[model samples]
Target: MTADGPADLSGLKIDRDAPPPETGRLRRVLLWGAVTVLALGGAVLAYRAANPASVPVAVARAEPLGGVPGAGATEILTANGYVVARQRASVSTEVAGRLNQLFVEEGSRVRKGQVLGVLQNADQKSALASAHAALASAEAREAEAAANARETSLARGRAQQLHAKGLVSQAELDQAVASDDVARARVKSAEAEVRSTAARVESAQVDYDKTFIRAPFAGAVLRKEAEVGEIVSPIPSSGGLTRGAIVTMANLATLEVEADVNEGYVSRVHEGMRAEITLDAYPDERFPGHVRQIVPTADRQKATVLVKVAFDRLDARVLPEMGIKTSFLADSPATGSAAGTTAVAAAVAIPKRAVREADGRAVVYVVEGGRAVMRGVSPRPLAGDRVAVSAGLAPGELVIVEAPSTLGDKSRVRVK
Candidate 1:
């Protein structure tokens, strides 16, 4: 039976497994899935690293329109100019002399008639003293002449009385009268000498006072042109070490802007015209001003007229010769008769270039913490290249001007 069973089993075929284990199949699928996912993640990281979302743009600060006088006024013309003080002067001595003492320095506030410098007055002082002595001597000589004239007249009267009593001859009376006349003439000559000396004393005093340099007006000293021991003169010197002025000063209260208007636009400007002044040093600050004067002359070469504009209220920030830009406005009686008196509608204004159209809406990219935040704004037209944002912006916010096409909400930006 065992031999027959073995022979039959050898003829029969055995059942074998045709598919791999289910666990092995599942493991292979998962390994490929992980590799694909890792590859995709790496690709994403590489793309992001190579291309950043940051954009470069120019930026401008949103400013309040109310603070800018004549912002709403119709600007007829614009011009560039310089700030100048109407009462500016270079203080110098009336007479040339070496400076002995300097009482003021640059930036020193001086009052009218205050001594700014004292010239070497040793010679002047000696001359003044000599003058005073001469005056005193003249006065004493005048008294002496009066006393001598009186005494001679009395002696002549006594001689006349004796001659009338027949105690003397007619010749003696004549002689007495001649003696009195001579004495009187001598007294007159002495009086003339006294008057001449007195005039000389006065002239000397005036010359002495000329040595002290005094401020002509109340102002701040802008420059110290002469130092102690330096020669200062009324006239400029080209020969030696002499300065024409001891100090240059200006009245800060009289600060004004002198702008040159193109001859074509000169008709738009007139005396008392309201203007908005912006200083180059303080671009954001606008000052209210009025046309003070139109210089009668014009520059033929530049074809420009010089217009002087005075500030409504002088500020300490304003200085002489500072560069400024001015906007001359058309008459707006409803706004106000004078500049800085009008109450304008409060709005935040930015450069027109800062605004962009996004999806049929006006948008501005505001920069905050180096990131651009998109804001929907309702814009209105403003003077010049400015847009007044009536609905959406606040004053002092930075808006991106010349925004790049790729700029988006919360995009990183580098302000140029």
Candidate 2:
């Protein structure tokens, strides 16, 4: 209601298009902040790409310590080895021949003296038959010779009686006695012939039996080297077609781990020392064992000694020639408890750097699915470099060593 014509509103409504100074300043500040944030984010990404966090794998694992299979064992030494049978044999024919039949296959369980395969033995059978006939003929001749001797003795007696009664001359009685002596000598020769024939028969029978391949001991068949119609020989043949063995069988009951230990470290191992065996096929399973024997000889080229370790108990999954790893345990003397039982504390010794103290408890970072997972463990002071964990951890689990401060539970990590 200004009567000075709606135009006298001077100085109040002059700049309708100009932006406020404070608003512009505020926008500039926000723009710069956003740019700074983007720049910092890009820098962080580049840094991460160049330098990724890495963690070393922990070597500690729960395993059998001694005597019996249990957890929390300390591994003193580790070696790669193979499962071997103490009583392994390659069954073959004594004489070279074409295999006629096979009685066993791979993984077949057999007993000692059980026939595993048979070779073609028609010729051997025929020879044995001939020997039997010859033996029979010789026996018949021996009987005939004995009958002649009896007749000759009777005649000699008759002649002697006649001579004593002066019914015959001395020359006649002498001739009869000489004839009896000849017959007795013939009988002895026939008996010798019969024995010789019987021996020949026995030899023939042996030859026939040699065609059958028998297991040397109770074991499991690992491989079949020969098939029907294939030639098998006890000795290696010059040709490739002939098989040197019929079947390769091993006494599974005698399964043991054969590890090649470094000559320098062999001194630390001895017979009856407790050991833990792990097969590649069954990595999580631990088999308690003991040192069976150390080979007297060392490999000159490898500079290693062969050590055989026997299982505390056998498992059906343990087979000959399987890849395995062995851990030799330090000997811990058994102590008698108040209950009159042996009390032994089996503890897993891990590198001290791998363990972290959190919330006044021992914690270890284990790798699972490419992530670091924390596990609480009961720890005790072991040696200078290690801590003994009495609980919480399993054999063959990958643990992160010297975990980074940034590592948290379920954090993504790369193990080196």
Candidate 3:
């Protein structure tokens, strides 16, 4: 076996010149294709980052000015304000005590004299019971005194007759007459005590009634200020352990807009002026309104006059404290009829930021079908941070506010 043991070992060696197996070649091609595809995908993502398909933008709707949008009335003034309830109150108990029960919650509609809550009245109940017992005892004493007085009267009469017949001594007759007088006095004293006890019972009843917290007027409860087991008081406590109000309620029927008009322009608005109101919560809705009152006083610090505007017809959607924009309409022939007092003009306004300057021309990026469309606008400066658009936009159309410089026509957008 000696010299031939490793014979023909060279023939078993691999041929580097030969092509790889079909499976190996297929796997290598696939790996290279995957790497190339991944590289292309990375490059595409980088390009997209530099040039976004859509832009993030702040937007505001083109709102009407002066009155209901497109109502075609002259707008005398524009003011921003909040809805307020003229008749609002924070109801509380007359006496301070731990809250025992609650019959209402936030948004609960309650009627006048309806029990809203109750305070722990165990002590008050005990006092009332005691007063009733005292009254009963006093009344019983009065009855006893009356009986004794009758008996004494009879005895006195008998003694008088006896004295007249000379059957009894003068001393015995005098004693009987004195007894009658004493008994009558006792009856009078007992009557006074009974009256005093009755008054005490009434006092106790008043104290007991105070434990129930009742609504002062019919209204919607805006907030439940006190919870069960919390101490409530008529007066606010400095220590903060007691709540000063059980609930805060407002008369929704008395909902009105309280706007502050610039003193410089106050003359343009007056009581009974026709107006249009748009609430921030319901921006698309135009509510007919009138100037209910022009507050006689002016705010010295703000240089503004408070104006109260009342809705011509109340809506269920209207709520207290909602932000609102009001257009005070000037008297015009269109609104001359008594029923046309709520007429408004056809004018539009938008936030000042919504209008942009492009090539010395005013432009705005209006959103349509999720795309920005640049349009020219004719803007007139208004009293506040708003501009009246005489052209190029319609009420309820959304325009990009403070749009980025990179944003262009036909750029996709998503409302924030």
Candidate 4:
């Protein structure tokens, strides 16, 4: 402390009025208040940056003004499908020979009678002609036999007349009768020979026809396995002398998806249920089809029922033996389109994020009038990213796709 003065006024110091000091209690209160405000502001900013709730959404979500049936409906099950037709077959014949001529190449359009190929049949053709000539000869013989039988009948009659007049003996009459009987026998033999010749002709004709292979149906040739002059035969042990085939023709319109429905889901897959086929070849487009038949028998080996979905339209790109994915739309459109001729019912489904557990209850935050309204919910099955909603959620209801902690009744939200 300075000894002389209550207030030191040094030569360097001038008298200046100073603000009054605040009361101790008020000063402490004001300091604390200021600290509290700053702390509160800092905490709010931090929280707004850290949490999704405070994130400013550029697009306002369409609020679920009200709940409707299927507000959060989701698909419970899903399966892939392939576009296909109902009638398809791989044609093979018992006849085998050297492939003499291939009438069609791969991708050639053909009619039912259009010959796909012809096999070497020089021997068969010659046999047919010979058999036919023999048949003609036999027919002539049959006619000659009839003439001889009539002549013998007349001779026997004349001999009988002579005997009656005593101009011919009984032995002569008997001889005439025998001669007539022999002529009848010749006629019978001739008839029999004719039948035999006819049989030969038919057999030869079959062999000749087999040599000229014909298409079984109207379709496009999918593959050509042989070239003209290539030796081919259907002989099983011919050491592959049987070149695979002259041509593989398929009615593309007859394509069908052979789907093996899981035995568990087969019961619901009755014939006439719609199906959508999306071929990997055409991913963006959907093909419409219908279940033509459900095999009553299940595959004992695979435990699945074969569901045949037939496409209504034919496309050149669609070929047999292609891998496919089929989806049964929940409410599949029945009508057809250029995109496809297939349709399937989609299963009830919902977004994966809408379902959550709160207070030990599986719940969904359904938006009602722009606010998150919590509701009790259940899920049927877990699917890709989405759960099939069994209860408490309806289709078309606005729900929070992103689940946030503390998301409950009356929470304000901005939906994407």
Candidate 5:
């Protein structure tokens, strides 16, 4: 280390041999500036190679379109829906009692008037027997009263004879007459008893009949709530009704699809509108149906109207509680199938990737005369592969399938 700058310069001996030493910040700055400019130019060249302003694209001829927007185009819509059985009912007991016997199980086919189950009826039996006995006694009494009435007439006749012949005292004759009157009253009393007992018999028979529960309609039993010997009661519980359905039965033939239609369009829907139904379980197949009913009531909260659809032809695969999608073609169909005209066959299609939104309109880049051009078009679904063009582009006009970022009107393009 040198103590002073003057001592170090003497030992270094001037390498004046090393040409005149460079000096001045301005000259050094200028030298660096040139090197930086060369480096920037090289970088710009590399970037041009990485991302070119002009992109290569493909071109294809547009198809001839009919006067119609596009031939064979389909307009698809999506809506949430649910499926339900048309004929549904809860089988409940009319009276409370212990279940005595259950013949049918869940999913059992039952006929109208078929015995589904029986309720414990020891009390009913007693009531019926008592009623029958009372009825019989009343009948016997009525018959006896009629005979007494006849006998009383004879007694009156005898009494009259006694009075006329003076064979008996006036007081004795009066007593005979009073006895005949009492017999007549007894006959009237027996007749009243018979009438009352007949009513009791009818009531008792009804109670007895109720003990054996029978099917109200011909259908299948979907569920069973009571088992043999189970003490079931229709009493109120936490749910307000302790007795649930004894069994669920449905007339499968009367089954229908119930769906909610938007209230805005419900007014247009009417009875007899043809419908296309597709089950979630069967995606490929579509079943035919007709609008059987449109519920007059609307669900105000949901703003939807309930529509009931009946099958035109029943399929064995169709069952209750399957999810379904219903398509309504029109409010009123003209004739034949209501699916509509086939527009998907004659339309020219393009991938959505090839389209772009510009100036608040749907547009696509068309390559024509060695340049990129924009064409406004209305797109509709076609064969699931591409959307058909409705307007603006003509047949045999080449369009850029893939749009380039730097592309513009009359922009040079290399077709790939």
Candidate 6:
């Protein structure tokens, strides 16, 4: 039987295709794990794409008002305005002519009576010369007439003497008197002509003076309206190229702010009210000012009244037509410097919009290292649209004023 079953291979069949059961299970598990990881990663990416991680927000700094004592009284009202010069003029010539010379340029400072420009003077000069020549001729004629009158008076005297002596007829004496009278009348007529010619000369001189455009007041030139060779007119001309003004000038010393107060809040502002003016161009600097006047009329369309605010001390930095913000105060800004010092010491203020409610507590999103740091603050109502931060805010920290509703603590924000 052992011989018959020679080299039976059934018990030892070669099976190279089959793997170990444990190894097969391990490979299936690894494949499924990789697929599950990829699906989860795709879901995470979609969710992130749907909801951005960083939000854009408008932010404002938590400003410390150096201790504004009675800030409430100090800033009773706020209004937007623009700086304007009380003495502003667009200087033009009295006569229309081609501009021959431009003495001043834009931004040039000029003194009163300074020659700013000159019109073409050839015609004017000619007219003036003609008038002078006429005046001279009239003077010469007047001199000649006076000489003739004197000669006639002497001749009449001689004739009377002769008549008295019975050496001349009565008719001869009468003719001599008539001749004298006629000569005197001719002299008078010549005198009148001289006066008329003198008046013409004066008129011509005035016309000649009109050719030079002079500054009415000392000021800084804001704009150059006409260049040399451009025509300038005293009155507006039909052609657009004819400029009515050679230059627009403003007295920098007379720079003031003209604010528009809402009619509803106009009652809060009054003449001589102290104010703090802030220029948009110079945000860090605050200029002291006072309400100079409240316009009698109101703008029907804007529902606002114009208020003039004059700076207490003029600064060269101040300019006409600059955007400005004014805060009307209760006391006079000129009383003393101490009042300003006190105002600077009183409070740290931030826009009311910066304070947001979080978990039933008043909190502010302070920006630090490009991330929003939620700080719980004890906010007290301050003047205008600001709140004083009694706690949890420093003077220079930036706070988010307008943020998305979903903004949370530690949220990354892009400040606008």
| C-alpha lDDT score of every prediction, in listed order | 0.83, 0.82, 0.87, 0.67, 0.72, 0.84
Error of 1 at 308 (Å): 1.2
* Residue-wise C-alpha lDDT for candidate 3, range 7-115, written one tens digit per residue: 5666788788997669788999999999999999999999987666777888998876544333466676799999999999999999999999999988999999999
User: In model 4, which regions exceed 4 Å deviation?
Assistant: 1-76, 84-86, 235-239, 259-270, 293-306, 312-323, 331-416
Report the backbone clash tally of model 2: 0
lDDT of 4 by residue, 1-416 (tens): 55774765477664568655666779899999999999999999998765536321122122221111133222233455454434444444457666766667777888887667777789999999999999999999999999999999999999999999999999999999999999999999999999999999999999888887677888777777677776665544457555655666677767888877788987666566555566776665445556788778987897878778776444556677777776543342355789977532222356556667878978767667656777787654322344555455444566666645655677666665
| Residue 334 in candidate 4, Cα distance off native in Å | 19
Q: What is the TM-score of each candidate against the true structure?
A: 0.62, 0.64, 0.63, 0.55, 0.57, 0.63
Q: How would you encode candidate 1's per-residue C-alpha lDDT over 1-416 as one tens digit per residue?
A: 58556445565675575565597889999999999999999999999886666788889998865423333467778999999888899888888888999988889998999988888888878988998898788788778888888988998999999998999889988988998898898788888988888898888889888987889999999999988988888897788578999889999988889999999889888898878788998786667678989999889999999999988767777888899999887644445655556544445778888888899999998999888999998876544567667556777889998766778888888988
lDDT of 6 by residue, 305-372 (tens): 99999887677777789999998877424333754643222346788888888789998898887778
Better of 1 and 4 by TM-score: 1
**Residue-wise C-alpha lDDT for candidate 5, range 125-177, written one tens digit per residue:** 99999999999999998899889888978988898998899888888888878
> What is the number of backbone collisions in each predicted candidate, taken in the order shown?
0, 0, 4, 40, 7, 9
Worst 10 contiguous positions by lDDT, candidate 1: 64-73
Question: Highest TM-score among the candidates is held by which one?
Answer: 2
The CA lDDT at 18 in model 6 is 90
lDDT of 2 by residue, 1-416 (tens): 56755665566777879887699889999999999999999999999876665554433454323332233244678888999888888888899999999999898999999999899999999999999999999999999999999999999999999999999999999999999999999999999999999999999999999998899899899998888999888887787878999899988888889999999899999998888787898776566689989999999999999999998768777777899989898755567778886746554656667788789988998788877788999765432355556667655676677545777887767655
Residue 91 of model 5, lDDT score: 73
Let me know the TM-score candidate 6 reaches against the reference structure. Answer: 0.63
Task: State model 2's lDDT.
Answer: 0.82
